[model samples]
Target: MYKKKYSNKFSVAPMLNYTDQYCRYFYRQLTKKTLLYTEMITSQELLYKNPDNYIRYTSNNQNPIAIQLAGNNINELTKCAMIAYSLGFNEINLNAGCPSKKAQLGGFGACLMLNPILLFNIIRAIYNTVPIPISIKIRLGTHNKNNYQHLYNFIKLVSKKNYCKRFIIHARIANLNGLNTKKNRCIPPLNYKYVYKIKKDFPNLKIILNGGIQNLQEAQKHLKIIDGVMLGRAIYKNPLMLCAVDQKIFSVHSIINKKILLDNMQKYIHYHSLKNIPIIYIFRHMLNIFYGKPQSKKLKQYFIHKIKNYTDITILFQKLSKKFNF
Candidate 1:
């Protein structure tokens, strides 16, 4: 059990293909305090496959990271929570907000919102099995039931157990049948007001708002009404923004040095390379590191070209250092 209180002031949302262990390690180079999460791993995968494949991290510095699991089975979830806790994860987050067809077919994700009783049971089971904190990531409502009252009822029922105290609410109604996962993120209007109201009504429960949060300034404004703010594509596409997270959000001064960042990534890539992992796997996450910069396109192109003709990790970084003046 993690004895220290976990801070949810700011976090990187657990994206499907984007927030893997390699990506989390890269993000750590930019910000140390911002909480990170693993990509949503289903309970079955953790049980059937080699668990290390899904939860491996490069170092203990990745501490305070949460593992997001998607499933509806009470026993599987409880077992998975124990596995995550045994592996030293800081928290277990149930995925009740994903609107993907795959998740729907598996009887999990956003569809779990339709069965608040089962969701509550799953949360209760996991909470009982693990001493670490448990959190739920959810959408406001589903389909035609997209309204304030429905959302309130869902939270009211789920919170009745009081097993999960932290809720990460994505301020959008999931249109499971009509919208694809990509469309679900945009087409459904964000109702941050509903999230704020949740905080108002459940004053003791921690409410972390997720959806359409673009920058740290916007996050700060939401933090005034809620406990935390979660960023998804905004941070993944321009991860350099995380460099300011420690200072601006956590009030901890951190030196953002490009040289230090390069050295750390170079060492990380080299370490993975020795383990027979492809460099491209690690480098792909960094393609957007220079986002919004004047040389962003050129740097990205150079990375692609080098990755395609990948040689030694040292050679690749040396070339990048000279060509991009890193």
Candidate 2:
């Protein structure tokens, strides 16, 4: 049912602390067809932390979404995948590409590439349990080595018996030491060839290219070689790009206006505010809505001031529309 409405050609990466329920709500208003990913949740968190707060979603036309989980334990990963499947998520993606310090300490993320068996077990466990598809996000290699053969072998071993259905490859090697995630993303050079080669080798496997793709043209170029494209900061920093992506790349014709985005967000803001959810949690994301528009800085300042006393902010959009002459 959900598959009929959503497309995965352009997916927003699972950025921690950035992609949340409130943020997803905002992005959905910009483009209905693009797949929205949840922030990285660990198997431990899904079982131990309050799962409702971690994986909440407001129903809408953007029905096809993926939940990204970071963990190496087979039982724990499987349990979390089943829960996500039960919650109506279309896909459960294992976080094999995250290079954060916290992720490394937890025995998950990009470091999973070093131990293929553990990764295989986790993937197998998730795929065996739920009918929902399983995907993996991975880097070319860890420890500063851009080895193609090793990456190919890792994918080969993991898919020895058709364990995973899709693989999202970030076109850079993850450095375990010395480089933080922010630096890792930019410092390491992107090698799109490895991802393309993977597609050539694994013809039946669905391969998605990620890293450094910022515009529709770049996405279109990569699509010629791979099955899909996944983007992170490029989309978050400038969300209007997704509107272009929906229309141009995927041929999805849901062009949402800025006013409509604000209108829809008002409903979400009201519901959450009544639940005592801090107004900043939702408004902080709105700060970048007008990326290149005039009076953006002024609007951001206005939101900062209003958040101080945002008890009745349902009409915040109306105020902005009138102030900007929208």
Candidate 3:
């Protein structure tokens, strides 16, 4: 369903605290083809957190969306995947890439790369229980260079056996040291050669390369070697890049005009305000959309701290439209 639904465009990474329904909806309004992903939800949290606040997704936000789960426990992960499938998600992705110490301490995330058997158990459980397809997002390995062989073995075991249909490689190794997530994203050099080798060895598996891929040119370059590409921080930082994705990567059948985006933002502002989620909570992402453009600073400043009311959001965007006129 995922491949057929969005076989042309690249995908937006599942950024934590950023790629929520609001961001997904806004991006979808800009382009029809780019596949958007949900923020990482830990298996334990999904089982224990109050669903009212933690697990939130609507069909209108992004229909072909994949829900990413962080966990190494087969039973818990499988249960979460089944729940996500029941909730109408088209695909369930295991988060084997996040390198946060907190995630590591929990015995999940990037730490799972060290134990392919454990990872395989989790993948197999999810694949067998849920009728929906399963995918994995992973880093090269944690702590050392030798882990790459095990990572490759893990991928081969899962992909060849059809435990999961796809694997999205982040193209870096987790340091598992004094580094923060931001540093983890950058400090670890991306190993594109290893990724190319993976594609070379596993010709039948669908490989999606991720990390440091910011624009269409870079994405097109990687697509020459991999089956797909996934965009991370860049998509959230500069959403207009998605417009280029439609034209350049997916070759979208039609273009979405700016008025439609603004209209949807207006509708969402009303909906979010009614939920009493302060307008700024939602508008914070829009600042990144206009970044690097004229008057962006002024608009960002206007709304950053003062979206107490819906009118504040309205006036702020109206002011930006008037000044920038994009």
Which structure among the candidates has the greatest TM-score?
Answer: 1
lDDT of 3 by residue, 1-326 (tens): 23346552489899888887777777787777777788898988899887544457676556778888998778888789878877877788888888897887998888877776788888777878988777889888776743557767778776657777688999988888778888999999988888899889888788889988877889999998889999878888788887777778876566657777787787888887888887766677777766677777776676665564445666766765554434
Clashes of 2: 0
TM-score for all predictions?
0.96, 0.94, 0.92
Question: Listing every candidate in turn, what is its Cα RMSD in Å to the true structure after a full C-alpha superposition?
Answer: 1.6, 1.9, 2.2
In candidate 1, what are the lDDT values of residues 1-326, reduced to their tens digit? 44555589999999988898889988988898888999999999999987665699854667679999999889989999988888889989999999999998999999989999999998888877888889999999999788889999999999876898999999999999868999999999989999999999999899999999999999999998999999999998888889899999999999877777788999998888899888888899988866877878988997898888886777887776665432
lDDT of each: 0.89, 0.83, 0.78
Query: Which structure among the candidates has the greatest lDDT?
Result: 1
lDDT of 3: 0.78
Candidate 1 lDDT at 16 equals 83
